[model samples]
Target: MGVLPLVHALVPNSVGNLGSLLETVLPWAGLAVPFALLAALRRRSASAAVAAGVAAVLWLGAFWPVVAAGAAADEPNLTVVTHNVGAENADPAGTARTLLAAGPDLVALEEITDDALPAYRKALDKALPHSVRIGTVALWSRHPLTDTRRVVLDPGWSRSLRAEVRTPGGTVAVYVVHLPSVRVGLFGFGTAARDRNIQELDRVLAQERQDKVLLLGDLNGSAADRSLAPLVRRLKPVQDAVGGGFGLSWPAAFPLTRLDHVLGRGVVAVESWTLGGTGSDHLPVAARVRV
Candidate 1:
């Protein structure tokens, strides 16, 4: 487990997409070191203690930055928020108010149903005047949105969109996406659909001409997963810049892994954090950045 992060890419996924599974819960592996160390102390085994210490070192070496992020502080220039206000969310209007309370300059939402769209629009229209939406994904900006269009990653439907936000700082391109979901069934990691979408999204991102870009929404995969390496390599995760928090944003009741993320290129993330549940299964993710 200690070495999983370094060799995650090399781990074969032909069987069950084990590599992706391990990466999804990679941070949790550090918990094992404490148990190992306790066992070593109880047994008074020098070799066991040495092994535990080594594991501790390796785990800390890889994740210390995430631990340190808790202390990060900054006066941000722009704030962006992203949330998957579940299709079945009981309180879409309340959720919209929760997001508005964060005072984000830009907001991206996913899994928005036709029924809930009106509630969201009514709640956010006045504050965030400019908006663009296609299919279930939407982008709302406090500034003007221009050159807006639907980004068709999958044919016959729209689940992604791109818009240019003319903010006081400058014009920045923002892409809001809701990638295919990943499920773990009897067949193993059911990520074929999600993986395909990731590749398609990567292709679209590659051709982007914007000097500054922000990608937000439910990616359905962890940033640590090798399958998401292409996008992770191209854009920096805002959580990483904060220096010390996992920013896990899913299963709001008891979030285990981060499915929602705020990623950007040609921008600096000064602060990043996750918000409380908004009557949805997933929590909202927020980032304050300098564009």
Candidate 2:
């Protein structure tokens, strides 16, 4: 029991990497191997078999609901848009125009450059009305903003921000984050920065008091990866709720994994989908949720 909490706390920071492993084999690791060993050891003992069965059920039950709930499609909604415009993007104006055309109630952008801000601001100013920008991440909304501040993902990197938007339904706290990218080299995968970002995000989520929350940005890892488990444990992806497949959003030419996402809490996702190719490396992901 003591170790369980420790493991749970560490899970999110490792979720991005673990997701693929879990989806492919981890679920069966516990039930198949351990239960099999117990069965063989106990032989035909009815008591041992029952105990093993109970344990298997309990273990599966704990994670099944979370996975299943994310898979379900529910109604009522808030339209949200998330995108990574790439610091050296080709055309900020065109990208911003495309996003505005989608009619998102709230927009979160990552990898924004100082030079590109003006173009984006001009493109979205009229439609969005209220906005907040902190370093490379920004949030724009149609509703009034109460509080906006930078969320530190790393000691020196100010690539995340949190904003409180007052809407008709209620005040919703939205966090826009851009985590450090992990790279695979001859040596291996570099995950130090990514891991630290996840830990910081976890800390922020834990302290958040708003009942309704939305997390958006370039997480630099997939939902299936274990490194994102911490955030996954607390939030539900819009894609998981309404997307058709993986909802790939990276590399406009050929997207295989979804790196951009919109996660919600105390909100219902009605529909979610990826938008057309943008000038940036990542395609825009949008979701309509019932607040």
Candidate 3:
């Protein structure tokens, strides 16, 4: 487990996408260190102690940077937030209020239903007048939004969109997405559907003409996972620039892994953090970017 991070790609997933499964919860593998230490102390063997120390060093070497603080020299020009306001959330209006409290320049929402759409529009109308919604995903901006259109993803339905925000600094291309959720049941890691959607989005991103781009939403895959290698290679995660200490934002009640994210290209993230939970099961994530 300690060496999993270094050789996750080599692990096979042919049976049940085991490789992806391991990568998704890789951070938790560090628990082995403590267990090993306890065993070494109880046994009082020099070799066991050495083995425990080695595991600790290996685990920290790979994940310590995420816990350590990071800083940016540039000041921020834009603040963006993303949230998957569960389809069954009882308080849509209250959720909007939670997002508004962040005072973001742009906001992205997923899992929106027609019945609750009015509540969101009315609540965010005054602050973010410029907006666009395609299917369940929506983008609301403080500045004018133009060149708005749906980006084809998930043949079953539309859950992704692209828009250019006319900010004071310049026009920034933004994508709001909610990839298909993967399931773990009798079958092994069920990620075929989610992976297909990710590949389609990757193609859209590759053809993006804009120099500066930001993607906000619940990707349903961690940046550390190899399944997101395409996006990880093209874009930098906000948490990497501004430390948020794991930046986990899923299962709002007790988040164990990060599924929501703010990723950017040709922009600097000065601040990144997760907000308190609202009516949704997933917590909202916010980032201040230097445009």
Best by TM-score, which number?
Answer: 3
lDDT of every model, 2 decimals: 0.88, 0.78, 0.89
Alpha carbon RMSD to native, model 1: 1.6
lDDT of 2 by residue, 160-257 (tens): 99999887778899999999987655534567788788998999899999999999999877775666889988999877766455577877788766
Segments of candidate 2 deviating more than 4 angstroms: 1-77
**What ranking of all candidate models by lDDT puts the best one first?**
3, 1, 2
lDDT of 2 at 175: 94
When 2 and 3 are scored with lDDT, the better candidate is 3
Residues 1-62 of candidate 3: C-alpha lDDT, one tens digit per residue: 66666778898888788888888888888888888888889999889889888888888888
lDDT of 1: 0.88
Quote model 2's TM-score: 0.76
Using Cα atoms with residue i matched to residue i, what is each candidate's TM-score against the true structure? Answer: 0.95, 0.76, 0.96
C-alpha RMSD values across all candidates:
1.6, 7.7, 1.2
lDDT: worst 10-residue window of model 2: 1-10
Evaluation by lDDT, superior candidate among 1 and 3: 3
**Cα lDDT over the full model 3:** 0.89
Clashing pairs in 3: none
